[model samples]
Target: MGYGELIIRSYDPQYDRTRVEDFERKCEVGPAKRVFLFTDTLGDPICRIRNSPIYKMLVAELGNQLVGVIQGSIKLVTVHKPPNDLAKVGYILGLRVSSLYRRRGIGSSLVIKLEEWFIANDVDYAYMATEKDNKASVKLFVDRLSYVKFQTPTILVNPVSHRMSRISSNVELAKLKVEEAEAIYRKFMSSTEFFPIDIGNILRNKLSLGTWAAYPRGESWSGVPSSWAMLSVWNSGELFKLRLGNAPLSCLMYTKSSRLIEKLVPCVKLPCIPDFFRPFGFYFIYGVYREGPLSGKLVRTLCRFVHNMASKSKDCKVIVTEVGGSDTSRLHIPHWKSLSCPEDLWCIKALKNEKKNSLHELTKTPPTRALFVDPREV
Candidate 1:
């Protein structure tokens, strides 16, 4: 079926809000599995990248009908060097095409146009993420777009429960001031690939709940902890809501049964799961870092603390985070295997050449497992 001429143009919220939201509804994203995922942008299509320093939203229109949408954001990030050793990188996200427009080149056209914008802005590199099993995305970005395979991070999700986990009596957890958190991150995480240079802005943003640190009860330091771990929480729920689709019947039955039992007997927790079948919100754990002995244990304690805090919010259903595939810290975080994605694929491309003999040529080297996932990108 031939659709009329396709025109790619910048998205204007004033006139495109409803059509964009409608287009988004038809583009529930995920691999074709018994369990997939959907996102509701909560009225604004660009909510995800709204707070970014440089961002753009483009829409593909066929005969005045919006058929595709793509969002991109540019930021200065560390490429594993000194604090001043930063590169301008563009992130492509929320790429979507209408079901009726599939295979008609709308998706690819939108991406090409966005890349042109990135090039015009002097972006050094461009990257994007998708599910590891998404063959279509792989074909589009890798096979067609010539983007190279980059980092593979695992997304960990632990649902908040009525039951709160008790932290070890020997551990002490405290909230850090925004300045303290920024100092710690710059001192330690500057070497992490893609660590944001404007991390202080992220921590001080309204959406950030705060940063937390955990350590042995008796041990402490003036500016940093000797044996400790720290993480920051971003209220991702504020940007969008998620709903699980085509979930397995066994899982659904368990969820319903557990909730029913809990209603019948309030005292019996029954491990009742939240109703993910409907739209729900979640907290994203970012800026995850640790050091010293038993730091893995400290990471686990920090996750439990976040889970307990999330439980207090009626809308927060899960605590989620992403870490490098080889990071041992994953072993310490509490998350359900079924609810977590073990391999989230990231693809990268160099739009401009790096300095001669520069070790900062990000596309040429494999990522160190110590990755700093930008919460804004999530």
Candidate 2:
């Protein structure tokens, strides 16, 4: 595709939906032979980014076909500085190019156009996340686009079992009212990197199932627990379906035998892996904030609580969450090593260096608080 023939414009849902979906189907994500991942936007290509305060989707057209698409959203987020030091940060995601038009600069053109929009909006910085092993993506962003590798977060995935995992009786879990949740988050997470300033809106969003806190039993209800953990669940499955492809024979057998054993013996407590070969939805755990000396236990209990809740849902096959590689809470969150990825790369670029914190300073600074993974970006 020639640069002159390619036209980049804002996506129009009326005529672009079907074409976008078609292009998505033709494009394969993830590594060959290891995993083939499919992301179903459930008919709305923009559903994932629509929840952000400011979002836009753009499409690249070569003649009559939608060959490429990219989405970007801007939000006021806390940076690696003093508490409440907020900056206009833009997030880039859902970049796709048609398989037939590879290496012809469609992907690059789409991203360049999106970054232009981010700069025009006065975005201080922009970042994106992708699998560390995605060489093409790494080259496009890190080498070609001048983005720096900032953070390597792990995607923690725990399969929702048929049987519920038990939480310790010593831990007391309570659902926090919207106001209560908002107040707690504002107090504790304001210093965390990428912490949204409009967290009140996130907690109150309809997709936010709710927020819950877990602490030791017999703690005073009025006061904060000495050792406690809090998290909010977002109904991401409602917006997209993730399908696992290229399953190995061993995995297939394990899933089958586990199901058969469960059917034959009702009392058996086998860890049954759900049928992931088909399309399935998932719950995203965000705002994984904890404090106190015994917060690890509280984090595990909260994870089990979310697991039990997911077991009741027909479509929810797995519980997924991401935390920084250095985040200590990763030691407590329950996840299968085989299913979870150890590193998801985040590449960032400074749109402008007029601010007090330069791009180099931001990259060199060590994270002081746990990363607050914004659910809207998930």
Candidate 3:
């Protein structure tokens, strides 16, 4: 059938089972595997939608068959804290189209529909990402729809063994209490790009742990300043790591959820956001202070702590982080070599009252004041 014959619609409760099965069969290759599996296993995509400040899901249908699906949500980019006068920017994620329906403008139509949804929801700008090698997707987003490439950050996955190798004799690591880690996290924020985090809220919502400095033997300090790591374990048995560092820097937290039974077999129970949501592994929530002589060392130390922890845990396999597209000073780190690239797919659309320049600049210009907010918030 021709592209015009296809119909697009939002996810419906009635179509759950059939659509999930269809998606599983269609998404056998490419980046669509996880998304397909998520939908199939969950049985209902709508249930996984995250209750964020703004949320949306759109799908394309060809007659009675499902042809394409697009899901997106709105988030406050607290990193920039743009003036309230400016329109709120939202992110578009979990967009997928079936392979059989290629070159038919189905994806583009879904994007346009999503843009309308954004406008109705009072969102000013929207953004999405695709792999650098996926020229077809790049063209669909960047060329046809005019979605600019915002931040392309590299994605890295470390086998458990790789994380273990980084634990050298020079450093000592220990788990810290949440309260102790929060105080140190506040200090770390003075130099990094991070949204203000609520320690209490984090402890309540998910499984979490903190790891901190043991104080190296040569340092003759009477009291050690608090420095640590923080990790949030999701329902899916995936661990998300974040770091907080002071002068004597260290990892802040490490958290992992235990698996649950599904159909008599153990299965990782991921956080219950909407099926359309994209799942990120780990986050680099804090950055090093540029002015300090030890800033570079601090960054390296934080990376090492993460590497060490991941090496020990077989379940924690991937580390996803975001760095400022504009920041050049602390760009190079030895451990970051395995990361894919520093660019991500950010889908965007212009609004009627919104200044084109604002949308244009966000997409074209490299962000200078970028901070890593927890993806859970997105």
Candidate 4:
């Protein structure tokens, strides 16, 4: 029990509707940050989360008042420890505590319970991401709890109104079958962190627009992807249509007039809205990766093509992707740097004894510069 006798228990839709809405209302991020990930098939806020069998949700209640919430999902991932070990890791997210409930130890209780679940599920590692500048979050996870500030990733967003860059003649942007997509992912993501063991499910999900692979025109599809990039596009219109969660004045104006207005106004910096707060008509691009010599150029081409395709839809106003801060791929993305939020921090800790002792070794390793944080998982 925490302050005011707080209680930690499973989330029940029937009783937690008002509480859930209140929690969602208090939070300031979206796509994943705005929308709760563990909702039911139809995305009914009150229904139980059935996104996957491995997912679970928890809520903290005090005096019959819901105050905090957290969710966890297990993924069998391959870590590059040496030859690559297939380890089950838990991705913890959707954490929110009402402003009235801070300093009550509700958050700590939730993480402890989730880490227990990870251990029971044979999860070796546990991790979650937050805005890097949130001092409260950083202190709670890193200083108060036994966690390490692992990786910082930039969340890239692009307004899709402009024309897209054309792919080079030698590069072919082809839409591939689920089988082809999975084959490429299995190879390119073998040494990646938090890689899904059941990538097939991801590729075939109902929301997935489709899986795409980019390669040289001369190459034939087969075992390994030589100079390549792959990504799955998710239609983000539903979430926005249901809950128009963006600021009213989101734009990409870079005219001389705009500069003059900014110069005249000392308080106003370049306007870049948050991803979840942006208005409707955007594609949340996920599971993106590039491999090869000209991978950067090729990947950029593929991304532009996707943006162009999405732009044709009246509902799609922007294209978004979250890439690790240290990932080489971020170099190629033409994102609104002034508008994007601060880097997202993914703080981590270990649950199993084998992983707990090896935490030091894991930290010493080259550090996972890039890993596919499936947008859907968020």
* Candidate 2 local Cα displacement, residue 6, angstroms: 1.3
For all predicted structures, in order, the TM-scores are 0.95, 0.95, 0.65, 0.80
lDDT of 2: 0.88
Q: For residues 1-378, could you state the per-residue lDDT of candidate 1 as single tens digits?
A: 666899999999899999998888767788767776788999999999998999999999888888899999999987745566778889999999888778988888999999999999998788999998999999999999978777899999898887888889988999999999999899888888888889988999999999999998877656556689999999999999989888889999999899888878888757767999899999999988889887999999999999899989989999999999888889999998878899999998878665323433555576675678988898
Q: Which stretches of candidate 3 lie over 4 Å from their true place?
A: 1-5, 21-25, 28-51, 79-87, 166-204, 207-291, 326-339, 345-347, 361-366
Clashes of 1: 0
Per-residue lDDT tens digits for candidate 4, residues 68-183, read: 88888887766655235777778887777777877878888999898888888888888888878777777888998878876677888776653445668988777989887887
Q: What's every prediction's RMSD, in angstroms?
A: 2.0, 1.8, 10.9, 5.9
C-alpha local distance difference test of each model = 0.88, 0.88, 0.48, 0.69
Root-mean-square deviation of candidate 1 = 2.0
lDDT of 2 by residue, 126-204 (tens): 9999999889999999989899988899899999986878889999999999999988887887877778989999999
Candidate 2 colliding pairs: none
What is the Cα-based TM-score of model 2?
0.95
Regions of candidate 1 where Cα sits further than 4 Å from its true position: 223-226, 263-270, 353-361, 364-366
Task: Pick the TM-score winner.
Answer: 2
Clashes of 4: 9
**Higher-scoring candidate on TM-score, 2 or 3:** 2
